[model samples]
Target: MNDLTINTAIQTALPATFLGRHLIDGNWVEGAETFQRVSPSHDTVVSVSAKGDAAVTADAIAAARKAFDAGVWSRISAKERSAVLLKVADLIEANVERIAVQETLESGKPISQALGEVAGAADLWRYAASLARTSHGDSHNSLGADMLGVVVKDPIGVVSIITPWNFPFWILSQKLPFALAAGCTVVVKPSEMTPSSTVMMGELLIEAGLPAGVCNIVLGHGEPVGSVMSTHADVDMVTFTGSTAVGKMITEASAGTLKKVALELGGKNPQVIMPDADLENAADAATFGIYFNVGQCCNSSSRIIVHESIAEGFVARVVALSRKVKFGDPMDPDTQVGAIVTAEHQTKIDGYVKEAVAAGAKLELGGGALSVEGLGPQFYQPTVISNVTPDMPIAREEVFGPVLTVLTFKTLEEAIALTNDSEYGLSAGIWSNDIHTCLEYARHAKAGTVWTNTWMDGYPELAFGGVKQSGQGREIGRYGYDEFLEVKSLVMRVGRDSRKPWVKASA
Candidate 1:
């Protein structure tokens, strides 16, 4: 193993184990016990975080509940909330390097990508700030001469935000600021595997002058921490981004309260390549889509449904490109692919690839663990599999890794059929130069967001979420901001002629 290091690292050697504490109400407190985070890339302990449990989860929820009920933040002026959000965005940008490094260490993604996720998240906060100023309801003035109706949007009280490990900071930004913009107080539970950055975000919230108890962070696993957040009576809503299985558990747990649940779950997102499409761009996008974030993205185009006429050529191009994708240390600027989040996850990724190969899917490029010269055995080769059938587990399941599966279709109808065959409807894309083909595919695709000529191009203004089992509710758009709010209709009789009471009581 080489001892070389990138400038992005705060120090050449591993820094002190970051002490992560729970942020409850306005205070940072220690948990019942501390858990250590060993860097998946470097193979060393990088953090020691407070391990919150049911009681701690309850405490954070109580804080958010009190803050919402108190109306300190819930009833604040939109302009004021916007100001705080803007400040938080500014602070986010200022602390990018600090947050990104820790995230890279814990999450095992490239530092460059981590930098982008943290830096890019500022735009989400900025956009949410804009939403705070613009979000409104409708007014129906055409009701009648004496009657008027007003629709008002109010913040759903305490919200529970559960974020995933992959793209942790980015996903949290997708939900948190929007909820705040909508005037909801929240308790956050980041994945136990990647909780440090959320703690850092809590610090920024304090610096941005967010009111005490408006946002609280509790670090721990699903059982007690996440359960309480989802099921608590005082919690008005739950917004979760993770696997569909866990999403189901939260759904069942939240049923008792019937609290609104917004889940951005897993996906088996597909990209269709038409015979008339730009082969080069499609191949390039396919490669990037599968490799970005090491394919640990909910929007990852894990499978490509290619037309039979172009299948062989496209597969060859993607295979050649996959071989060229640099897979190594995440801290290095040039490394395109990096370590998997854990040995277990890496094993899971390889298992899927192996299973596919065993199940008659042909391995086109790579399909197993890769050893970085100086790093631990936590990296996987950029894998590509062709001749994948619609029935294969790899083609249907969420193999959240740098692996791509290829399936073929002779007709557009067949392509659409293959794309919609899965339970996941998070995202799907088509590469076609023909306008009709692209438009037709877009309209017919069951996914929430369809890319006519691109893949996974997201914007804060464009709402994102999935249909079917990929999960419900939206995030990161006007729709996302609306998720944290409730609508109320007010009907008022104008001119107080002591308007129409159905019956006059005891004249």
Candidate 2:
């Protein structure tokens, strides 16, 4: 039996079902159909959201297109756009408690984690505000004695932004604010499971004084909502954060129009440990890495490639830490871990653990579901699998749970090989006391971000994305802000007679 405290006391009063509507052209509109949201943890209704169809998506696309073409938002001054962004950031801070409560209830994550994600998202908006003012293009004055060349950066018109349920508010901030910073109007589709936070963001956006039709929220599934958003001719680009399979579908959907696509998808990230490293700190980090957000994050270090000399001790340390992590009511402030998002997801996680054990891997810890005293049985225990080979699915696939797999490596070369063996190339962590080891991994690891002596520490200034099948394009920093923009070159002559023409009049 797990010794972690299962807090049975409920402090916060659950609110009545929230009404989720579509935000189109500065108006809150109702859909033809509405779907109810049942909290996975409490097994209670949390929201009733408008169900969007293809027609609704088309309307949203039209609104964004019209808004962009009319220059209602796209043609605004950078200072004006930046000021609105700052206000949005301020409003986010003001509404953190309200948003966090709903996020925890709908998403089945701990209130603490939800609070952190929502609070931290404001920084992204603030940083994007700064980016709007500093963004610029290039010019060439020495093209010729009487000629000049200039390049201008402009918004890429309408964008379709689709976010996943795991990190709804935080992920939306990553894409939406950057697009706004580039002066691009957008239509966003949040995962049906967690639509309230995005709707909440729409409320914040409007209160920040964003112009009509600048940002629209459409609630529904991927089919009619996200599908239309991806394939519509009026949408100039699609920015998505979800599974790699859906990302692939978006890539194919946008192919006809050749619209720009930016995706942050799945990851089977690994963290490498050296014998000379600080083993205690590394073990603690590994424990936190796999369990944070219940390991549902794309950046989670699901597997750890450890040097053979210290493998056994490191595994034991992590297992002990896992045993002590609190897993219970999400509303409790002291709970370290919370419920899984859904029963289906919990079953998938258990299947991976069972398959790994059947494939000759040793189960050092949990491998099944847990029923908290006051909640439904949607919680998966912190699991650890050892004696895992690089070829095993448990070691290679993106399990996306609070489960950690251990693969042993005898040398630095072997560790690096094991890290790069997977199809994913998103993020990697290296824990080593030797400068040479960390630097070598930094140079060789085929991931977008490399964390040396740390894991998953991100900054708004640093770009985030992946290589190979993980995804295309970055999500934050200067590069992320630039992704929503288009560049054009202009050549000018000082006088009418100064320009040379290649075409002859006789022709």
Across residues 119-152, which tens digit of lDDT does each residue of candidate 1 receive?
A: 9999999999999999889999998788889999
State in Å the error of residue 158, model 2.
0.3
Residue 67 accuracy (lDDT) in model 1: 91
The top-ranked prediction according to TM-score is 2
Span of 10 residues, lowest total lDDT, candidate 1: 1-10
Q: Which tens-of-lDDT digit does each residue in 28-125 have in candidate 2?
A: 99989999889988999999999999998898889999999999888889999999999999999999989998998898888999999999999999
- lDDT for 48 in candidate 1 is 93
Off by over 4 Å in 1: 1-11, 496-501, 504-507
Q: Each prediction's Cα lDDT score?
A: 0.90, 0.91
